[model samples]
Target: MIAANARIGVARSAYFPSLILTGNGGVEAATLADLFKWSSRAFLLGPLAGTALTVPIFDGGRRKGNLERANAIYEEDVALYRQKVLTAFREVEDNLSELRILRDQIKTQGEAVDASSKAQRISSVQYREGAINYLDVIDAQRTVLAAQRAAVQLAGAQAIATVNLVRALGGGWGNATSPDESTQSDKDALTP
Candidate 1:
């Protein structure tokens, strides 16, 4: 938006006057010996300094075309930027949803791990009292290990979702402004 405005400004400036400066200075001599003699040397200086004002009268619509092109490019960039912002928002929402679901799974998995641990303890006690075979205790321990592994996996998934959410939110936990507000602020910053 700002770039387009600046291009328009430059195009308008073509109608204004520009200041220019010029200068020339040199020395002339008939021979090298005479060049070293101040009386024999002819020097020219401060005789060509002058200023001119230049004004553009016409450009065959070239300036108008350039301004239009710049405006078109600015519009295209704004559209692309808005699309990127929307995509980011969508990703943030998706990751948040995943984190919520994974948290629930982790809670349930924790309960499963606790139950498996208690069952394994009971199985060991029964085996020591000769109420159950060693195989029963070993099976109980396997169940506990599986449950714990599942809980760990769920925790890992939750962490990944959190990281994704942070990335989608531009590496921060703060809420983002609406797209309109963001666009306005960006334009304000870009403007001269």
Candidate 2:
């Protein structure tokens, strides 16, 4: 954007007077002695030197077009930067929301697993006392197993959400370094 602004300045300057100074220097190489002795005097005696002052007489709106183009480029760059920032913010928000939902899911799933395990234990006791059939105990065992499996899967998903949140935040907290706190090696790693 700064470069684009500088280009705009250059484009605007096209409408102003331009002062151009030009000169050429050459050694008089008629002979080796003349080349060594007359080199200093050759530029003043043999070359043309001049200064030109030029104003934009007529260029058919070229300067105006260039200025407009430069301004457009700068605006485009600013819009692109804004879009990138907005995308980054949206990603962070999404990760945060996912993490929150997964946390609630894991918590509820843990409670469900606990409840199912308790139910299975009670069904086993009933079967042992001959008050319920073995099939009832088996059903309770299957329910407990399914609940435990779901809890484990929810935990896995929670872990995944945590990793994604770290990624959305631009990496793990351990990877961040403030300028004043950074080590020499860290600075060297960032130099490129």
Q: Compute the lDDT of residue 87 as modeled in candidate 1.
A: 100
Which numbered prediction scores highest in lDDT against the true structure?
Answer: 2
* lDDT per residue as tens, model 2, 127-155: 99999999999999999999999989988
Runs in model 2 lying further than 4 Å from the true structure? 29-32, 36-50, 172-192
Task: Give model 2's TM-score versus the native structure.
Answer: 0.73
Model 1 spans > 4 angstroms off? 15-55, 172-192
Clashes of 2: 0
lDDT of each: 0.84, 0.84
Q: Write the per-residue lDDT of candidate 1 for residues 14-105, one digit (tens) a residue.
A: 66788777665455678776666667644343424666678877989877787787777778878888899899989989998999899889
Which consecutive 10 residues in model 2 have the weakest lDDT in total?
Answer: 38-47
The alpha-carbon deviation from the true structure for residue 72 of candidate 1, after best TM-score superposition, in angstroms, is 1.3
Clashing pairs in 2: none
